[model samples]
Target: MPPQTREVVVQKNVPATMRDGTTLFSNVYRPAEGGPYPVLLTRLPYGKDIPSYTTFLDPVRADGSGYIVVVQDVRGRFASGGEFEPFASEYEDGHDTVEWAARLPGADGRVGMFGLSYYGKTQWQAAVTKPPSLLSMVPGITWGNHLNGAQMRGGAYELGTIYSWAVTTIAPDILFRRYRDDPQQLGRKLPELVAAIDTLQAGGGYDVLPLTKLPDPDGLTPFVREGFERGVDDGWWEQLNIDGRYGNVSAVTLHIGGWYDIFLGETLRQYAAMKEVAERRGTAPPRLLVGPWTHGNFGSTLGELDFGIGSSGILLNYRGDLADYHLRFFDATLKGREEALADRPPVEVFVMGENRWRGYEEWPPPGAREEVWHLSGGGSLTREAPSGEPDAYDYDPKDPVPTLGGSILMPQIYRAGARDQSPNEERPDVLCYTSRPLEHDYTVLGPVWVRLFAASSAPDTDFVARLVDVHPDGRAIGIADGIIRASARESYPEPGVISPTAPSPIKPGEVYEYRIDLWATGNTFRAGHRIRLEVTSSSFPRWDRNLNTGESGARSSRTEVAHQRIFHDPDHPSSLTLTTVEG
Candidate 1:
């Protein structure tokens, strides 16, 4: 660390005009004495001055780190002009903003972008435009596909997330837009809106059937409803997929993610795709950093368990703050300095249970072996398949499996990461298979998958698979989980459908193989610990329950109970595959 050598200057509400003649506003921070310096930009819908908007890095610290920092309000936000249509105006508007920042008075013609979540998304959108001055970007906990990871995961709607976010975060802006001119009317309506959002967050109003109709009579968040109305995944949603256009990006990227992040799956995909693109172009490979954290909190404790003192990113094994590390990274990429990352590894991850950070030259860390554990009789999880009959369970949409905790982006009422699964496991609808206590310490540090041969009485149903670690005292903590709707079983982007709008129906007694992606995990199960897997039909609130009807979406009010049979016989061996890391 060094002392400040130059006077700090601040400029407020600087306007940048887009190609469409709409003006977006920003606040610039710079060193008054410096002739020119690399510019750092953050574009977001949240107000530029909102200090608590992101947990990743601070703009004031970034400005003090000897760079010109520009924080802008994206189109249709606080100080900007234009109607806000999420993901529609970002590409062109972001491109125009980056180019504008490059020409700022203290800017050195090299531009770098940084932020997390929605701001992270803006960086990816901007990069696709291929601005020559944009040098590097650091995107934290963002998605590769809007339809898949951001909006829905494994063909399940993010019900609680969409509802909470739309009401609490986006509705206020919408209200302001509708009543900006009438102060008296706006004051009168704002309290009613606040009360409505409060009721929704407090857990009473979420049970509203037919998701398209919310706010009682009419929908307040039209965008949230629009997502539900889209029956088929097409190129329309793919237009927001940054991973598909990675070849067009020339900037070196640093992808930072959390182990318990809702976007972890997509974040890893983005890093891998960018790495391939960099290799093809003969440029520096993309770097990845993952820590034990939720969407907002990055600390030793999440939910009920405290990992350890070393788990916090700020105090990570005596390393300096994460913000300082990011400053060093920018120094290397934007200023061409070699002191920061001269000996740094390409990938850094925190292993839970062990509570230690490990660095690797590549993702998956090489030499990881895939081991399959079959679902056997007597609720046993073993390497050998059973010779008996299949296990059957009844799933009622009226009473779906309650979501406990594990990588959720819903309301704060449902905390994320590593909570006890006893409440959920107690339900008869959830079938559990537990492994005997391991004789040796086993490390699983990569992607986890569950392959199931199942049949549903209903034409359309849902399948959920969860991976858990069972402690000696009988605590089952959820590690990771995934879901697959029967309609989207055959393929992704374009699912197998009987008609253009409706998904194909499953024969009542026929068996079909389903793959459930549990995403990636970095954990070390101790010798005394037991590995557990739970099979169920739904994770309510986190994902909307399938009403067991041959309908396109949850818009249908008709519901039916589904009889689900999971086959584990020799003919159809259902198994859980773990990526084991061997030293």
Candidate 2:
């Protein structure tokens, strides 16, 4: 049984000063009867009082559990004071806030942090500062670098997610300030502004030729235009990148990721990096928990499928609910309780298909082997490479492939997670290569990628690959998918480069080896399930359409159709690399 806690005290609009004299506001939730309790700090641009469905950390509940919870509004939002430059100023602001939280009236010296998405990023920013009071952190569904996860991905702008975010989320913050003096007027205007943005988004305005002309001419969100203009990954990206700052984090880190989350790859990368950091310093490796969830929806149902009751974070039998799991982790890390630390595995993963939670010592669980399945003629995916002429498809930029379901972060309009891909797969632009039914249970546990030796009629184009699990009823549920702009090939330096946004045009009608990162997944393909691979040049509205005529870097609405070729002969062996887990 849990210990009886004291009455909760909720303080509103508490101030914490940064080094630059900017004051950030936080709501402090503390036990009214406790002497001093450990601190859990969550700093985010979202209002401190508002509950985030993603993180789902209730400060009131944490306070009742005998901890002082500090939920703060970061600089330039709500009660905080400063110019709102996203990703910038977080390190310093988070550092100052942590130090301040440590000395609060009912706070112990130790401080831990937990939140999802941007809130999770604040924890990393604070950890990088190496604040003396910082002890542990649980950063969920966030990224190691902004370019890879937040802004752009695989040399393409995250049009749907970022643009919608600018219009819906950030634009409202700006509106709040514009009408703060007249709350009544602001209240009426906010809904109208949202409705306007919604109309634009749902009316196929996102498919407009030039992406630069987005957020409409009325200035809903100018930031969206800034993202389109800065195609090259240059100095602006360097300022927000926290790749080299991992070593500075002294806190024991726990990373939480969703298989279908937009930042899945980035989340895994950070976990591996921090685990290596701990090994180098002779400390315990970090923990990782990956669910079969979307960005924030940690429920049993995702898209058209349900993984039963055990799938939801709210029903995890291992450690009560998600909140209880967090509390136990904090208690063990912050207070160093022996009983709380007992028998906890370093890694926990929810394997789809089989729909079961499994524990492991590390990610990519040891003994996972790379199994290569070759793409062949007659729209077949098999182990043998067939000698045949390449498959051809006409890719028109105007009528590119549509996004069915997978990992995407558009406004509420775009659905994510596993969904039937029949609608999109039926398109002529999407070339389907399906495999025979599996003879035995096959489990893929790590990164998935496809190597294609293909030629294009244009100087630049795009190659999109998707892995689907075909059910007996012909439902092609998308498991993983990725895209690569032909121009950004090999642009990254050895051992590093955040998704390489620089354009390096390819010669027309030239065959080049393109590796499409399909990201990571943990799924057991039971016997009789067929594996399907769809090759396409676009996944519309999810990614900006890649105009085949290579001049996308400049402001040109001109587009050209390209003849795409996929080779699967012995000389040019196109294959899918699946990290198959051993039974």
Q: What pairs collide in candidate 1? A: none
Can you write out model 2's per-residue Cα lDDT over 330-357, one digit (the tens) per residue? 8888988746757667898999999988
Tens digit of lDDT per residue, candidate 1, span 1-583?
A: 8774656788999999999999999999887785688998989887887864446677667777789889999998888899887878999999999999999997889999998888899999999999999989999888867645577766778786777777888778777877789888789888877887788667656666677765721244678778877654555576777756888888889998887888888788889889899889888899998888888678889877788877787876567767876787899999999588876788988888777888898887878888999998878899875655788999998898887878888777788888999988888899999999988888889888888899999988999999999989889988888888887775442221111233566787789998888888889888899999999999878888888887745477778999999999888998999988863
lDDT of 2 at 157: 71
Model 2: how far residue 144 lies from native, Å: 1.8
